[model samples]
Target: MQRLVKIEMSLFKDILSGISGIFSGSPYRIILSAENKKFYLNAYKGAGAIPFAQLLNKYPQLGDLSVWVNYEKGGTVIPLGNLAYVKKELARLISEEQKNKPEIVIPQEIQQLKPSKMPAGFEIRYSWNDSEKAIQPQLRGEYWGEGTYVSENSYWNMPGFTENDDLWLRKNKIRGQEILEFLRAILPQWQRRSLPVQSEVVLEAEPACTIKINRVRIDSVTCEALWRVNPGSIAEIPSLAGYIIAGSSLGEGFNPAGLPLQTESGQALVEEYIPKTIEKVNEFLLQQHHLGMLDMFQPS
Candidate 1:
C-alpha cells in the first residue's frame, strides 16, 4: 500500500527548507498554495513491515495518513490501525501553525471603499472610455446585478414580453440611442454615432431590473494617433471602436427583506431583472455622453 500525507508548513524559507530535506528521497513532492495557505506533501510506498509508528515518533503532530494498501500485494502487511489517532494530532498542529503565520494581504483600491452591505454576486469593472485611444480617461464603477456580458448573442431572453411589450420595446430602443449620444459627448472630436441596428430590452423585476443591450454598434474613426511612426501598419484600424457593456442592478438601496422573486418558469428574479438593469446602465452611459465622453478607434 502507498500512503499520502499532507503537512501545512509556514511560508518562512527555513521551515519550507526543513520539510524539503525530510522528503528529499521521494520521487515526487508537491507544494501548493490555496486560500492564502501553503501545503507540503510526500508520496511513498508502504508495507506492514515498515510501520508508520517510527515516522510519528519523529513528527508527533502528523494529522492524517491516507493509505491505500494493494490487496493483491498479499494482505500480509503489518497493520498500523492508529491512522485515526494520527489525524487528530495533525489537526491540532495545523491550527497552531496557522495562528503563528498570518496570511499576506495584497493592497488594492477596492479595499478602500466604505464597507457597504452588498448583495450577493455584485461586481465592478473599469476601462478607458476609449480603450484604443492613448489619451482617453478611464471610468470605473460598481455593477449591481448580474455581471457584464461579453457577447451580444449570449444574453438571456424574457418570457412574458414577447413582441407586445411596448414600454419594454421603447425603453430598449431609447437606451440604444442614449449609449450613442453618451459616446459622442465623451469624445466630441471623434465623429461617430450609435450603430443603426443596435437595440435593447429593459424589463422590471420586483427589487431589481434587467437591461439587455442587443446588437449595439458605434461608428467612428481615430482622431489622430498618439504616435506617428508607420502608416501601412495601421491600415485596417478603426477610427472608432464600440463597447457593448451590459449589467444588472438591485435598484438603489439594499433591501434584505426584498427576497429575489421567481419568474413563472421558476428562474430567479435576477434573470428577469437583467434587461431593465442594462437599460439603466445605458442611461448612465448617456449621462457620460452629456459629460462629453467619446469612443475611439484606429483609422482603417
Candidate 2:
C-alpha cells in the first residue's frame, strides 16, 4: 500500500532557496566535486550525496534535471532546464492534495526521497564510525590590534566606565599578543619565503572587509601569509584550497612592498573607487612591512 506523507517545509528550505533562480526558465549546469559532496552531505544529512546522472536515471520523472557524471575528472554536472515547468507541476500537485492549506503529499516518506544512486565519479569514503573519529576544527583566538591600543589620557577614557574600559583595553593588548603567537604557530616552512597580502571587501548593508596575509614562502621574493578576520565566527573566511588569493613582490629599499587589490566588486560600484581602495590596502601593508612583519617570511 502507498503511504501519503505531508512534506515538511524545513526539509526543502535549502533546495527551494537555492533553486528558485532556476525558475527563470534559463538552463544551467552545476559540476560538483567529492569535497563539495561532503560539505552538502554534512549540511543536509537526509538528502545525502548521490551522483547527479545516476539520480536522474533512477527517477526518470525528474528528466528535466538533466545531469552528466564524469568519472575521469571526478565531477557530476546537473543541467536544469524546464525549471519553470517543474515548479508549476510541483505547485499543482501540492494544490491537488488536500486542497485545504496547500500541502504536498508523496507516495513514500519524505526522507525516503533521497537519491538512490551514488554519482558515477564520487563515493562516500568515510563511514559513520570514521566520521565520528575525524578531527574537529579548532577554535581560533581573536586579535584586536589598533582597536585596543589606547594612550594614557583623558580623551581615551570613557566617562563613568573607566574600569570596564581599562579591562577591555587590557584585553585588547592580550589579543594583540595572542595574534602574534597564533601567527608564529601557523607559519609555514618553505624556502625562498616572501609575504603575500590580500584583502577583499564585501559591500553589503553592513559593509565589511577582510585582509589576508600569507606567511609561508614559496619563492625567493613571494611568500604567503596566513590571514583571517573574525576568527572562529560565523563569518570566518573559508580555507581556499589550491588558490592564491593574492600575489606580491618585494618593494625597493626605503619603499613599501607592492601589493594589489584582490577584490571583485560588482559592476554597480564606481570603477574609480576600486583603485583608490587598492592604494589604501597597499599603504596599510606597507606600514606592516616597515614594522618587520614581512621579515618573518624570509628564509631562516
Candidate 3:
C-alpha cells in the first residue's frame, strides 16, 4: 500500500505552499513555495536523509507530541500513525484557530461600503464548471470583506489611491532624476501645509495613501518619508499591519503593536496618523542639532 504524505506550509507574503513525497521510500522531502515559482529545501536535508532524531533533539516538543516547531520559516509534517492521533491533532488545530481567530478591525471609511444585507453562511465554493457562481454575487453589488473572487474588483473605497501611479513609475523607470523630481514636487506642498506636522499628505505615486514623504528640520528641513504601506499586494485583508517611521532620526519603531489604524473600505488612515507620530520625531531632531543646524543643513 502506498500513501502520499502531504505537508501544507505557509510562507512569507501570506502565500500558502506545500511539500509532498512518498512517506516511506525517500529520506528527503521536496519543498515548494506557495506560488510554485521557486523550490527550496534545507541544505542539510538535501545533503542526506532528514535527521528526525536530531530534529527531535533540537525540538523537544517532537518527543512528547505536545508541541510543534513554529519557527519563522517552519512548518509541521503530517503525522504518520494511527487515525486516532491524526484526528485528535486536527481537532486541536481547529480549536486553536477558533479560539484565536484574530479580530479584523475595518476602518469606518471602508465599513460604509459593505452591502446592507450580507449573505449569511453562504460561502461561494469554486469548481471548474461553476464559474457562474463566482460572477453572480459581484453583479448583485460589491461589499467589503466578501472574500476572494475572480477579477480585480474592490468595493472598499480608497480615496488616497492614485490611478496608475505605480504603472507610470515602473514604465518610466524611477532613477536619480525621477526620485529628485518626486522630492521637489512634494517639498513645496510640505512647506505650504507643514506636512510632517500634518497626519497625511499625499505623495505623488500610484495608490497615494500607501506612501508619504515628510520634510522635517534638523538644522534645516531634511526630507523624511513616512507611513509606507502596501496592503493591496497581499491576498488577505486581515494581514495589512504596517510600521511607522518614529524617533527624531529617520528610523523605524520596533514596537510590536504596530501602527494602530485599521484599513476598511480599502482606505488606511496612515495619512491621518503620520503627522501625529512624526511631530515628536521632528522636534527631537531639531533640538539634537539646533546648535550647528545651519552648518549641517543640506538642501537636495
Candidate 4:
C-alpha cells in the first residue's frame, strides 16, 4: 500500500490535521561520534511518517501507528497506477460482485487523491549531551550544503521541547540502550561502507516521487536500519537497512533510511507553506507532489 500517496480524501485530511502536531512534539537528536555537526532529517514530512502521536491522546481512535504514520485506518486504498484505469477496474469488479450477490454497493473510497511529500518513520539518534564532539569540514549529513536531507524526516523538534523526548528503541522490547548498542556494534562497519574515504558524504538526492512500499522482515522488532542513502555506490557498499515499524501486519516492516539528515526551519516553512499553512478546512485537494529540491526520497 505505497502509503496511498495516491491518497484518499479522508486520509489526506487526517494527515493534514496531524501536520502541525508533528512540529509541536519534542524531538531527539542523534550524535554519531565526536562530530558536533547537525544532521538534516525530513522525518515527519517524508513519505510514511506517523505524525498522529501528538493527536492520539485527544483522538483516541488514532491508535497503533505503523511505520507509515500518515495512513489512517479507514480510507479506501486506491490501486497504484493510472487513476482512471484503477477506477474502471474497480467498477468492473464491483459490478461483477453485485451480479453474484444481489446487494447494492459502491466504492466507499470516494475522496480526492493527490500525491504529497510525507514522512517515513523518524530516526532519533541519542547519546549523552556531554559525550564529547568534533566537527568536520562539511556538514555531517548534508549534501554539499544543499537544504535537502539525504535521508527523509518528518519535522524538526521545536525549541523548548527537547528536554525530554528520549524513548527506548524497542526492538524486541529490549532496552533502548541495547538497541543503541546494536547499532554501535555495526556502526564502524556501516560507516566504513556508507561514508567515503575522505569521510565525505556523496550527493544522492531523489525527487518527491512515490514508489511501491517494500516489506522487509525483521524479528518482532522496531529499530533503526543503519544505512546511508547514496545510490549507484551500492555495488561497493555492503548491506543496508532503515527504520522498522512493527506490530501492524499491513505496515509492519522496515522503511529504509540512508544515514544522515539536516533540516532548516524557516526555509522549510517557505517550502512547506501550502501543506503547513492549511488550517481547519472541511476539504482540500493535493495534486501532484511538486516538491522542488526540498524533497528527499519517496518511502515505500
Top TM-score model: 1
Backbone clash total for model 4 is 33
Per residue, candidate 1 scores C-alpha lDDT tens digits across 33-68 of: 111111112222221122334443444433144242
For residue 101, model 1's alpha carbon misses the true position, in angstroms, by 20
* lDDT tens digits by residue: candidate 3, 184-288: 453344346432212121223332122232343333232332333432321111111121222111112222133333232222324455454444334433533
Worst 10 residues of 2 by lDDT: 247-256
> Scored by Cα lDDT, where does model 1 land?
0.25
Which candidate tops lDDT?
3
Cα shift from native, residue 84, model 3 (Å): 35
Candidate 3 least-lDDT 10 residues:
1-10
Error of 4 at 40 (Å): 37
Candidate 3 segments whose C-alpha is farther than 4 A from its true place: 1-8, 11-158, 168-174, 186-300
After best superposition, candidate 4 residue 141: deviation in angstroms? 23
lDDT score, candidate 1, position 196: 12
Q: Model 4, poorest ten-residue lDDT window? A: 28-37
The per-candidate count of clashes, in order, stands at 37, 11, 7, 33
Which stretches of candidate 2 lie above 4 Å from their native place? 1-48, 52-58, 67-86, 89-300
Give per-residue CA lDDT, model 4, range 5-97, as digits (tens). Answer: 222333445445555544454221111010112211112322343333433443332233222222334332222223334334334533562
TM-score computed on alpha carbons, candidate 1: 0.18
Q: Kindly report which residue stretches of model 1 are placed more than 4 angstroms away from their true locations once superposed.
A: 1-16, 19-31, 34-123, 129-300
User: What ranking emerges by TM-score with the best candidate at the front?
Assistant: 1, 4, 2, 3
lDDT of each: 0.25, 0.27, 0.27, 0.25
